[model samples]
Target chain A: MDSFVLPSFISPNSEDIKRRIYARIRSDLHRIEAEIDRNINSSIPLISVVARHIMGSGGKRLRPLLMILSSRLCGYTGDRDVSLSVVFEFIHAASLLHDDVVDHAEFRRNQPAANTIWGNPGVVLVGDFLYSKSFLMTVGYNNIRILEVLSSATTKMAEGEVLQMVHSDNLEVDEEEYLEVITRKTAVLISAACQVGAIFGGASPEEEEALRAYGHHLGIAFQLVDDTLDYTGDVKELGKPVGNDIREGKATLPLIYTIKKAKPSVKKRLGEIFCAEEILPENFLEVREMVMRSGGIEYTLHSAIEHVQKAKESLDIFPAHPTKETLVEIADYVLCRRV
Target chain B: MDSFVLPSFISPNSEDIKRRIYARIRSDLHRIEAEIDRNINSSIPLISVVARHIMGSGGKRLRPLLMILSSRLCGYTGDRDVSLSVVFEFIHAASLLHDDVVDHAEFRRNQPAANTIWGNPGVVLVGDFLYSKSFLMTVGYNNIRILEVLSSATTKMAEGEVLQMVHSDNLEVDEEEYLEVITRKTAVLISAACQVGAIFGGASPEEEEALRAYGHHLGIAFQLVDDTLDYTGDVKELGKPVGNDIREGKATLPLIYTIKKAKPSVKKRLGEIFCAEEILPENFLEVREMVMRSGGIEYTLHSAIEHVQKAKESLDIFPAHPTKETLVEIADYVLCRRV
Candidate 1:
């Protein structure tokens, strides 16, 4: 996934770039939404209800958007692009459902999690339903490569989640271990999304590898930004609490960096708060102040921008097209998105 | 699945019958075990640990056994039977892991559940790993029908679980609704096992239909026996606690039958115990006795025997061989086996 970091300048006019990319892909995004709605329906009423509850909850659909734009960038002219885009959304949504259950998350997208409303069993099974549905959709295309990409991605994603659980609340987890977790848990699926689109577009192996690398760096950059935002983001914009990662005892990049840079006394204090039976509000606030004072957020943002620069560099091999421009703009957008 | 009831003489010597069937397939069963052991290994250590914990637990591997034996019945001579059988075991193990999490089950096969040891997040993610692994295995052979059968079965199984949850603790759930739940939850996967084997064995269309019917009926009978045993079997023999279905607020076939046949006062008492906030030991005993007096166990057993007979009858289309005889004996064994 090209894990080593390099520095680059962030685009100051990111809002204009984001709007331009959104305007270009606006129609395709709507088509992807339609396909998602149609595919989520089930004969069993509860499956539909629980699935729709999560599907309608406002995920940015970034994975599917990446897939569709990548397909277009590779000059895909077939009608299957929207259908294939549905596969990414289903996979993304299914993981979110299971993720919420695993994390015992109360709120998702500013609403109660599906587990809270339907109970854990129903939520878990619906996640299974969505997963199988994605596979079912894949078979209709008679494409073995798509199935291979998705199956491997899912296995790695699950492994990443289990690894995260093993590292949960451990104050000794290092940056390399944290990077491995995010790459497996987050980057692999996004990479698959872009690679599968290239395959469908009939891209050469070289083009496919370039797109895969692009997605890998962009995904890592995206997650690093998310981790930085956990300490610095507004609760209303983030759709959850500000210090949720602290409350959950997750050792994200910012927290890991903060622990590394803190004074000995502050390190012990942060570790006690992080490894506490329950992190009290005052302790959480103190940990947040310590992270900010240590310049953890800025350091994490610098790392994200490095990955984003690498992501844009991977796309330089492709010819200049509007779709290619949108892809680059989306990579830039990952660094600036609030939610 | 032959839902209608019929009277049949109980086999007086099931041990002899079970021995005969097991002796016929003993070699193939061992090979399936080896395949399961090989396939369950993973890059992430905890997946292997959690998977092995459940896979080594005392499941009879009934679904995979059906697949292997059915393939042999169709005169399969190749090694793909072992590989195909692994898919069934993986699917069944994945469902069991998720089931334990959903049920909050403390014990399975007289040992603590994976969720109890690893926590729900790890367990749920491992279940996902097994599922994706199964699909990954299927793609190696490039068989589309096998994928379709498995994908459809998994979707139906999830729907069945949600349907059962919807009908939980409801006295109004009828025999038909109960049949639907068991068919989707239990029978579809078993049917898929036999059908996939037939597909692999190069069976004719008529033979495939016959084998599919055989599997479907046998699965229903197997589940009916399980529901009856919930009320009447010994705890040690069952390998878990008795009356577990009742304690879990499940309305199995026996409970549905008893609710239909009970006297006015007995019905009220049973309802009180069932719908009570907490069912005490004495209350549980009363519910068991009332079910016995209402002939719920016998009625459910009769229903099971009828399905077993139908299962055996479905084999008439095939020419008689040792494998076919063993399949018939296996169906009869379903009527008499204790666990």
Candidate 2:
């Protein structure tokens, strides 16, 4: 949460880092996604169906953007970096697929989940397809170290998913464990995108480390803010239901804080409601008010802001450049955005 | 079924080849599975769990033997071929995990299916762990061609699963589609192991093609014979129930063939039976007799034998090397194996 809101409060002068490098990065990310699209299994009509469903849904394409922007910030000047950027996005998409399966989610970004429409097996297979394609894409670079970084990231993501699974329906899940899950399942890719970009851009070890930390912090901030929004933000703007975390039995920060502060009877009532796969709107509303009255939601938002701040602080080592400014702007947007 | 069975039955000296390769391949398979046990997931406990589940299960490692023996027959002996021989088995095992989830299978090789024991998500993630480990091993060879071969094979296997899912509970699945599904889902890796072995062993293009044909034909034959056995084999030997395919509504060779020859009512009975997830022993026996009476089982076996013959004929290009002799023995053994 330290990383989530820190960037916005810190402030940046640049609007969008409008440079040739930025344009090139955008072009490169596009190419990488196109290449990955080529490699995904052409057989599963369901895959194509769901992919079209999601890709055409006008996503922010944030991960690919981060990878390309970070690469450019480090002065990466090759077409290969573009290919690597695509790999990063594919990794993110793969995680999202598995996450929905784990979450048994019915929706994503205000739209239907692939699994909800196609069933779990199709979602699982398409996720597998994306994973295989990403691994194959890594084969093109011939960089063993890079492969290790990405493979290890993926392995960690799966582990994080398992960890989260163990925590499911357990209201006692702490902030430390939740943080760890997001770090592996989310932040690793962001960190890896930056690290790979720096490596490809010819950054030194220290610079690479700095950028990796920045991306990792950004990813943590991003997810924390996302979690916060699920409880406090407007559903119309967030493009999903409000207070969704409780529905999944996920011990999101707001709920955890509410549990910690609630009366014994209230806590017991909350537990019974949150532990189920389904939650009625009436119980959901009651829980929302309890969390708010207990100061849980505000506390979560503050923590999210802190995460954004940490994200900004990580960029202190990087020199003042437009790329750096844009990175800072992304962090600010992450925490402050109503959506 | 032809290629799978005839090699074992009609090979002039089939027994000799099986005898020589059996012990050696078994040792090598253990070594490779040892690597799988050692290097599965970085999450140590999960790796141990996978080891416990997979290595703990008692079963024959026949695929690796085919790879090693087939490669040796192609007039080349190298360590990578054998290492990759293990990779083939690992792929098979990993696919088994996902297959169980899709099939909702309970028993495998006389033990609980991983999904049934550890649950679906555990089986899925561990399957993924093995897959990533396999890719890592492939990349270690720095053999791009081999990586491509195995990668493409893996993709096909996933696709085949989806195809099977789409076709599930549908008795209308034809031999052509079933052939496509199994060839990709099961046979491709078997064929890939042989193809990769030939390539790694420095077989010429023609020889490589011949060996590839050997693997392809043999793989299809093997699946067909196994399907036949699913209808006819003894429970004590086969581990799982006989006619498990029909129970799962999978129109394997015998049922697929027999459906064609059955009276309209008989065919209708099959359609109903094929819609089930499990069938009682009484129904299984009734279907078996009905299939045999319709000559469905016999025709499928005949086709299987034709495949085995073609697989053997492909080996004519390899001359009469000892490895070639073992390959012949393997062909014969594959035809007769019960479990």
Candidate 3:
């Protein structure tokens, strides 16, 4: 509901801050990656093969990183953080596999999507395996609250996907409805990751909420940038062509904005394109250009930047600490990332 | 690993016993159905639509019924049994939704499969919704053991599907591997249902073990009968054609037995049919007759009857009670059910 507004608190050295933070967390990230590899193995060779195919195709481990950083920000020092971090990764990986199947996506993270290689049924089942496996791993913690948060996040995520499906390709979708979709589909998991990290770190309720807010805003910003990048990012970095969202008839933030802000003639043309049975490559590029002309990309980036600022502001309740600084840097990284 | 050897324990009047048991538990079963109906409700209308479409379709509510009967057999006299019964049903229904997509099944329980009506993406996501919703419900129990059992069952179920995929259309699949697949895919959930019911019912460790074994054997018997029904039952009652397993290239117990006992020429023909790109309807009928002539149906029924006897024998440790009697009757019903 909040408009994109930059507060007076953030530093301009985001890139420099991210570089230092990466160096500090390098070993921990390695351990998390190792645990992720170990956790995905199964007695069934194909399950392992399909799981490894996607897991090995690296995406930035942003969700797991949030859990780790939030734990540190809460002044927690425990070995459990490493394994706990892997839980969100499994959930994220599982969702990506399913999403790829749902989207009929060909590439993910600069590689062929798991569905493209293993077929939809195998990918779908493996996604289920990862999901159940994540829950199984959480039982070792013996914490009901952790399970509650994780399970609730998963439920909301599924609901979010359904909501997105309900609203798919509907040109009437507004900013508020789009926000709801991204919140459920993407932000809930990120928020849960941070909240669970706080819970494991023994933070007070207030502190937990603060971190949760930070993660929520960060996740929203992350997804906003993701949607904008669908029209703006380079193909090599995105591992797919620009205008894919349009091809799939997804009314993402930029396109939705474009529809609202464009001239009547432009809107009419956009409607014609959307109504067409096949969206040709040239039409896709034409829509991208029109969206740019209508300032949709800039508006979306502005919204994302505002969310990044709000995310950093949410962390102001926490005391100044090294981990808190890293969290701020990650917030900046989300805005600055090209893919 | 054990051979299917019929024991001298099962009563011949399974149908009469089942009818009496159903008469007694009529109220409890009704309550469970209501809870299941309540649990499946969602804010998303489409999700509710997709979920209800499948949940309302009449498949035997066998898994949830097992949980309720197992709870009652352990002398559980609480309302939790009714709500808890819904958990296994949600899991079972969720698995069925996904399985339909995986098997590309057109019909289930005399209705078009949810996947067929809602499309695969919506059905897959709704299945996920049910899965997470089920977990969310379990967290309300605040019992870590319940979470453990449910999560483990889900993991094994996913693994079982993968194993089945690996074995699909492969005639070399032996009985041992087939049993492993069915156990992971189908038996584990039933076993978890009973074990979870026991946990909620305050069963002693030994009592829990007995119920768990009862469920495991009953699940095996149930699946054996299911495979046999695909060969022997009326299509209207089974809610599917008789040659579906053969069409899908699944090597169920009946087909596996037929492969093992058929004459060399028959075995070669069976191999050829399985290897062909598409199994013709006439060929499917021919294979069915061959399996029948090779005594495959009889062997599978013998195996199911043995499991039913084993399932009943596992209940010997429990004291005589009406609930125990019902549980025993249900075991026999698993053997004799036509659909």
Top TM-score model = 3
lDDT digits (tens) for residues B1-339 of candidate 3? 112222244455657877887897788778877887888789999988988888887656777888888887777887777777788888888888889988999988788888888898998899999999999999989999989999999999999998898899898888899899989988999999999888888899999999999999989888998887777777776777777887887999888998898789988999999888888878878888898788887888888888888889999999899888888878877876666
Best by DockQ: 3
Q: lDDT by residue for model 3 over A202-318, one digit each (tens)?
A: 888989999999999999999998897787777776677777778777898888999998889988999899878889988988888888778787888888889988999999899
Predicted candidate 2, C-alpha RMSD: 4.9
Minimal lDDT window, size 10, model 2 chain A: A1-10
Error of 2 at A133 (Å): 2.6
The 0-to-1 C-alpha lDDT of every candidate, in the order given, reads: 0.85, 0.73, 0.85
Residue A79 lDDT, candidate 1, scale 0-100 = 65
Of candidate 3 chain B, the 10-residue stretch with the lowest lDDT total is B1-10
Model 1 residue runs over 4 Å out of place are: A1-9, B1-8
For residues B1-339, could you state the per-residue lDDT of candidate 1 as single tens digits? 112122346776868888888788789888888988998888789999999999987678888888887888888988888887888888888998999988889888878888999888888999999998889888886888778888888888888888888888888899999999999889999999999888878789988898899999999999998887777666776677777888888988888898898778877878888898877777777888777777888888999989998999999998879888888888888888777
What is the DockQ for all candidates, taken in turn? 0.77, 0.39, 0.82
Candidate 2: which stretches are off by over 4 Å?
A1-44, A74-84, A141-143, A199-207, A254-321, B1-21, B40-47, B66-86, B198-211, B261-269, B272-283, B313-321
TM-scores for the candidates = 0.95, 0.84, 0.95
Ranking by DockQ: 3, 1, 2
TM-score, first chain, each model: 0.95, 0.86, 0.94
Q: Model 2 over residues A179-218: C-alpha lDDT tens digits?
A: 8988977888888887877777777788788878888888
User: Higher-DockQ candidate among 1 and 3?
Assistant: 3
Model 1, C-alpha of A328: deviation from truth (Å): 0.8
Q: Could you give the interface RMSD of candidate 2 in angstroms? A: 2.2
Q: Tens-digit lDDT track for model 1 on A6-93?
A: 2245555657877898798888878888888888888889999988899887778888888887877888877678888888888888
